[model samples]
Target: MSALGTPRPSPLPAPPPGAPTVSAPEPQEPRSRKWIVWLVLILVGGLVVWQAAVKPRMEAQAERASAVSAIKAAKVFAGTLARTVRVSGPTSSQEYTSITAPIMRGPEAGRELTLLYLVDSGKIVKKGELIAQIDAKTLEDHIDDIGDDIERAEADVRKRRAEQAIETENLTQTIRVAQAELDKAILEEKASETRTVIDRELLKLAVEEAQARLNQTKADVAHKLQAHKSELRILEITKERHVRHRDRHKTDLVKFKMYSPMDGLAVVQMTWRGGEYGVIRQGDNVTPGMLFLKVVNPAKMQVEGQVNQSESSLFRIGQKARIRLDAFPELNLAGKVHSIGALAAGGWRQSYYIRNVPVRITFTEVHNKVIPDLSAAADVTITEEENVKQLALAAVRREEGKDVVYVRKGDQFERREVKLGLSNNTHAAVLSGLEVGEEVALEKPAIQMAALR
Candidate 1:
């Protein structure tokens, strides 16, 4: 106010001497409130980031994991695709002779015969060689008993004949004596003319009585002879029956020892016991008419096997096959289908309901190792296609009435329809709509995709 007659600016008040000077706090918001607001803003930003990026990423990761776990994939390949029917069975011979249990008779009839001895299987046997022996003790005993009975019956018949002869002789002598008496009586009656009337009458009565006695004696002798002949006939019949029975038992005893009729390898027959098949051995009882052994010509070998009904149609009379023996894996034999059964086997009452057709495969060349009853597997080539694109059957699926496969495209599968040519249990030949070297899903991919959705 003193410089040019104008008012001067106001100045701060002076502090007290030697005292600490303090300025009042400027007007401001609270620190705690500012911190709370900044914290709230950060939380909102984090929630927004999670909703925009992290949550979706985590969900996608879960879906990818599920897809990986659920789907299986295979690579398609180009190769020579051959549709083959595979079957397994025991090897046999085309011409074989079966040795069966002998026909039993007499006391041993209608009962199973015990196997007393059996030759080792796979032995080469000549004609008339013993292959098996059945228990003949019972039959022998029966034959002995029948022989005794026959002897006894024959003796009885002889004794009866002798008695008949003796009785006939005695009756003949009595009849001769009666005839002599009648002759004497007749003479007496003729001489009666020289006697008195009363004496003549008496002599006539005596002659008539003697004649009646002779006639009665003759009738008695004839009747006795006829009865003796009838008794002798019955005894002879009994002796004949005993002799026939003895002969029959002897015949059965001879049959107990089985001999091979031809030169071949002998194979034991399978006996059905306890609901399963087992090799016939000594001590195993066999019924009459049961097959006990088979003599097979090793020079002419064949395979007897069964094929499923599905593959039966592919087998023909001349279809070529390659056989592999399970016992001798190194031996590979060539063969052809010789025969196909007209009926299906193994139906109801079987452990499984699989129907099979009997097939006979004849070997083109015989080998010593390819013996009878060796287990073998045959691969019969039904059809062959060259340089064809094939995919596993598992990769092929049916969708909308069309064969479809899922082709892998950049970590994802794309559905494509395919035209199938030749197919088998394991693979299917693709004629169109699929390419070689492409990866295809072996299982359905739609399930995993649906789950992800």
Candidate 2:
């Protein structure tokens, strides 16, 4: 208000000396609050986007990745392909000697024989080596009893001969006495001229009676001699019967001790006893004629296997085979088909049309580890080829009457038709369409399944 009606400004007051200065906080702007709200909304929107779209996309991508990873694939290779007729069965010997329990005769017949001694299974034995022994005690006792009977019969024979000698001597003495009596009567008849007629007639009658008695005595002696011979014959026959019995028992006793007839491995066979089938052990009783052991000539070893009737045509005598022992995998043997059954055999429980042919494979190469009854497999090579490109049979699929393989190209498989040549169980020859070292899916691609879904 001092100069042209305009008010003048006044001067501010200063703080007190030594007092602390105080500052007030500035107020926040509305634009700043708006910016904070927009930031929170953006974060929420980002979370919603992750839940509805981005995460699902990532999950689906992971699933696709997993599906792609799940597909099994293999690379093709070039090698020899052998088409083989595979057969499986227990190993056996082509030239083996079988030892069985002896059929007991005489007193010991109709009874099981007890095993007294058994050689260790799989023992290498020479020809004539003792492989097993049955209890010979029974047969031995039987032989002893028969011997006693034979001895008794022999003694009876001798005694009867002596008795016959004594009886014949007595008869001879009787005949001599009768002759002397007849002679005395003859002398008395000669004195008949000095006696009465009655006395002479009586003397003649006495002579006649004496002569008849002498003849009767001689005839009786002849009959008695025949009887003695017949009695001796009967005794000799009895003794002979006993002797035969003893001999038979001795033979059976000898058979009780079994011997290996061949120079090879001695393998005990399983026998049915006590309602179960098992190897014959010491003290185990076995029926007569039951096969108890085998003397297997490993030199002539073979594998006896069954082949499907349809596949029997592939086998022929002298065809080469490769044998592998399941017990010893390291042993690979060369063999040849030696024999095939002329008839097909089928199990009663199976279909009548389902038949199998027995095939015999003789081993060309011998290994010590090869033995009888071991589970073995034979691959009889029917045909073979070299430098053939092949893929697993599973990798090839039949489509529209054509062989197609799923060839892997990057992350996907491309279906390709391939020309095939000779094939086997495990692999198929790739003649044209497939190349070596190319990966092919062994199974259906999971990527294809996902696409279909």
Candidate 3:
């Protein structure tokens, strides 16, 4: 219709040969262009995919990368570990004391008074250890015997005193006699003064006679007094000796009962036979120097532990120590090494003790629970640690001798090589190849999960 439009197909443009025609873009609304753009892109993409397999190559490369990263890791390291040393032993005492007494007289014998009270081996006594007592009846009998002897001695002394008094009276009488004679002689001599030289001979003869009588009396008195000197001295000494003997006997009797010398429990010094393991009774007899009982101080107590040669090396002087009594485990006690053993063990597996060089420790605090004879154990730790990586053991995977972790990157999981340090059943330590706060896959791969359970 246009060619004729009739008026001359006004020379329509000649058709071009085998040339692609592109349509002019028409002006469009925003809503209308969105669908047309999407359809054109879809068609182009379909043709490209048909010509080349894009998805297969992408998948192959991803699989190759995953295989490369799934290697296991192991490390050689110098490990320092905490070791414990165990030991067991009993305890002992440091000081001991003894008490003695002498028991006397009766069926118990003439020994000192060590009998009549409770005393024996293995028997404990209080501070005032009165193991035995003197028999009251026996002591009373002795008193009676001494009283009889004292009475006899007193009689003898009194007899000598009487004799001495008699001698003194005789001496006084002799002196009086001599004085009277001398006065008579003087009176006679004075009376002779009236006589003259012719009659002086007769008066002189009378005076001489009186003088001779006085002289004789004086001589008799002197001889009587001097003759008994030795006898008098003997009598005095005997009386003194008897009195002293009585006093000394009484004093000795008082010392017959003995008591504990120190403030502590007492044990029977003598056994039923012989040793520190017997009973002492009130009726048992003893000598002046015999042991009666023993005294032991309580209050001083300690804990003891035994260690083998191998374990002893870890235990050093000044190292920290801890103790927990089976009776009181709730109570934790601290202590320091006071000393270590000086000698080797004499028995197998520490069955015997040398006691010469046992390792010793002084407690920091006093615990009443540790008695005189108590056993205990100890542990010593030497290793210390600080911040380190840790993880749940279930999340880690290993292939060959290498360790691997699946880290989440974008939409897919990527395999990563990791360095592992140490592990226990529940936890594993990460040495390197990972950082804190990074996303990692905890959910197991399907094949790995099935085998793990």
Candidate 4:
């Protein structure tokens, strides 16, 4: 044992036997991890390729197949086909009375007529009911003045007649007195034989003088009588003129109170005032001959529409129509064309090149919701066919100067030519080359396939 506290290392024993010189086994080299990293990288690369390229391509192919199988198509059907022209305008009563401001006469003429009373708009009124009244105070005053003038004229006529009678009576007395004097003179002349020659000569001259005076007096009486007749005639003519004037004013007074000519709904008219168009109300000043209101019979209504000149030929009297009021969505009434204008007229607010023909449609059925001046649209049937083959317009395609449709045949669409008759916006009447229950592609099959791809 060593003196120090540390113990000595133990010595290895030598391999004594020569069976094998065993050396310490060499440390085997550690396997590399690079192959495992490469394998992980390879697997990651394959995953990226599948997500970015393979999956999207597979999805696209699936969608293309679905679109090719899902092409939209429709079948030709037998139905009632009608060609209609849409006309829109305002609805109005067929029977209506236009009420205008009364034209004043006499001194009130040319003056602005003020409305004193006005009925409420949209009021139901009976015939002969007062609808409006113009301010007649001025007119009434003028009439009174005319009446006074007429009275004065009549008085003057009577006074002139009395004066003429008195004058005639005095003239008659003068004529009688002159005749008596002439008689006295003649009697004196006859007594000449009882007197001397000088006395006889004086009596003869006195008789001649008296006779001349009587003739002159008679002439004066005739002239004065004629003059009196002329003066009386002038007075009578003046009085007649005043009476006629009064009568004219009386007629005008009656006009001031306006009445409904027929039982109807009273609708006030719009007038231009205060720089804008508005309804005429009480206290508004209306001019002579100006239309202020209307009395429209609601039971008898019509639509006044104007159609293009090109379409005028399609419209004729007695054509059936379906009317729709824009104000009331639920009301659909039947009507017919009542009249068509013989000559087309150009609208004042439209272009000069545009001409429209006036059309009137009378309602065959009355509805309580219908009212005058409401905006309405009508479908006038120009031609109609029942139980005819009709095809959807979307199914048609114009190709090579002809109309063609894609008729479905098994798994393919065959392009087929078709003859079209009456056509509207949505469908066309198939006159030939198409049968009922045949399916036609709404969209081009080739185009839809290409678009999906």
TM-score of each: 0.63, 0.74, 0.42, 0.78
TM-score of 4: 0.78
In model 4, what are the clashing residue pairs, if there are any? none
* lDDT of candidate 1 over 1-453, digit per residue (tens): 332233554666889999899885554544676687789899999999999999999989887766765677899999988878887888878788988888766655789899998988889999998889988887778788888998899899888888888888899899899889889888888898899999899888888988899899999888888888889889888988888888878888888888889999888878778898888888999888888888989988887888888878777898888999999999888988889999988956765667889998888977888887789998887988888889999988887899998988865788899999998779988889987788999877778667657
Cα lDDT, model 3, residue 39: 89
Against the unseen true structure, what C-alpha lDDT does each candidate score? Answer: 0.85, 0.85, 0.58, 0.88
Steric clash pairs (candidate 1): none
Per residue, candidate 3 scores C-alpha lDDT tens digits across 116-183 of: 66555444456565655555556556656667766776776678668867987987787787677667
lDDT of 2 at 152: 100
lDDT computed for candidate 4: 0.88
**Candidate 2 least-lDDT 10 residues:** 1-10
What is the Å distance of residue 430 in model 3 from its true position? 23
lDDT leaderboard ranking: 4, 2, 1, 3
| Backbone clashes in model 2, listed as residue pairs | none
Error at 225, model 3, angstroms = 5.3
Candidate 2 lDDT over residue span 214-258, tens digit each? 899889888988998999999999999999889888878878888
| Model 1 accuracy (lDDT, Cα) | 0.85
